[model samples]
Each structure stands twice: as structure tokens, then as C-alpha cells.
Target: MTTMTFTRKDPPQWLLDFWKEIDDKTFGKGFDCFAHDAVCNLGVADWHGRDAIRENLRQFIDRGFTAHHDVVEYWDGGSLKVFHGKVRMTFDDPALPVVRPAMAHFFYMDEKDPAKVRRWLGSVGPIEF
Candidate 1:
């Protein structure tokens, strides 16, 4: 797995591990980071529950796309955590550009349980495709 570098504050270990699981294409492990009742907003659609979120994420992760996330900023405020990053996505299709600059924002809600995310509001912008 590639090491992630953050420009601002360092993120918690659990968050790092969660991202690692995603980068490693291990949805099962990554989905464990969210609560069973967690909600996820993927910009395109909103998914409720960890199971639904996992399925949505799995579809993208399995779409012949490999990504490397470079975290530019991170914030931790008790029950909330926010992270902004640029993801480098490479596609299997040679016809597509190898590098596309895409930015991602992740807002994690951890009110009741600090260990698990209760809600994840995420968005990826400037999608050229």
C-alpha cells in the first residue's frame, strides 16, 4: 500500500487504517469503520446503512479504477472529523487519461461513538468523465 501524506494536521490512526483498507481494495475491512446505521453521501447519491454504503463503494472500487489519495488537510473536532484530499485515479482503459486531478472531501460524524463513523458525507469533484 502507498503511504499517505497530509499537509496539515495528522489524522487519527483509525482514519488512516480506514483509508488504507479502501486503497487496498478491501471493502469488508473498510466498511467496518462505519456504524451499522451510518449514512453515506457520495455526491451522486445518498446511501443509508453500512451495508448500502459498502455496496456503493464496492461498485466503484471494482470498476477497474485504482486510486491513491493525497490528503491535503485534516481537522478533528470532538464529534466531527473533516479531511480534504486529491485522489489520483488510474483506469485500465488506455484510451482514458492516466492522471486526472480529482478532489475529495470527507466529513465524518462520530457523535455517539468516537470509534465508528455515524455518517459520512463525501464528494469528489471535477469529474471529467
Candidate 2:
């Protein structure tokens, strides 16, 4: 068996780019680039791996949900990068068409080559409207 060697590097720009990709896939309308085992949390649900994550997003898109993220804070400590943000999600559901105050915390590891996100954690709750 071969061991994969990962090096530490600046994470801010790279992580931002990754988030951009996710945005594109979710709202901007693009492809998904996360690894097979990537985990994601989207307010009402939790997903593990790329397929599940894709399905989760696909469900939102199928229901005509669009989202925009407002980044509040960002920190890059070499190998780890953290982003604190909120997302505004709008769907066609007439009764509950919008989801606001959606908070997210993205954790990135091995910034040198971010092919695999070691972990990603996110949550949504009521915030000052």
C-alpha cells in the first residue's frame, strides 16, 4: 500500500475557491468537485460522501432553491482554514419559501492540494433579522 503525503500551505484563497465551486454547483449552477467521502450539513439534513452530498443539493435544486452566502469571518492557519458565514436560501415553497439566518462553518485541511476536505461542519439557526 502506498501512503499519500500531504503538505501544509496557505488555505484562504484555496478554501475560498472551493466555496466558490460549491456556490456554483448550488446556486451559480455548475459541477460538484468534492471528494467521494466528503461530508456536508445543510440545516435540515446531514450527508456523508460525494453521492449523498450531491443528492442533497440536487434535491434543493430540483425544488428550485437558490442560495447566496454572506461570509462573515475567515481565518487561515496554514493547514486549517475556517469560514463563518450565513446563507440565504429561497425556494418555490409558498408556505416556507425562504430560509434565512443559515449559518455555516467550513473547515479545510491539507491546503496545499485540497482534493479532499478532511472535514466540513455547518449549522443553521435563528439570527437577528
Q: Which portions of model 1 show Cα errors greater than 4 Å?
A: 1-8
Point out the worst 10-residue segment of candidate 1 by lDDT: 2-11
Q: Residues 30-91, candidate 2: write the lDDT tens digits.
A: 22345557677666567887677666666655656566667777765544455667777766
**Clash counts for the predictions, in order:** 0, 0
- Give the clash total for candidate 1: 0
What overall lDDT, based on C-alpha atoms, would model 2 receive against the true structure?
Answer: 0.58
Q: Show where candidate 2 strays beyond 4 Å.
A: 1-33, 41-44, 93-99, 110-115, 126-129
* Most accurate candidate by lDDT: 1
True lDDT of residue 83, candidate 1: 84
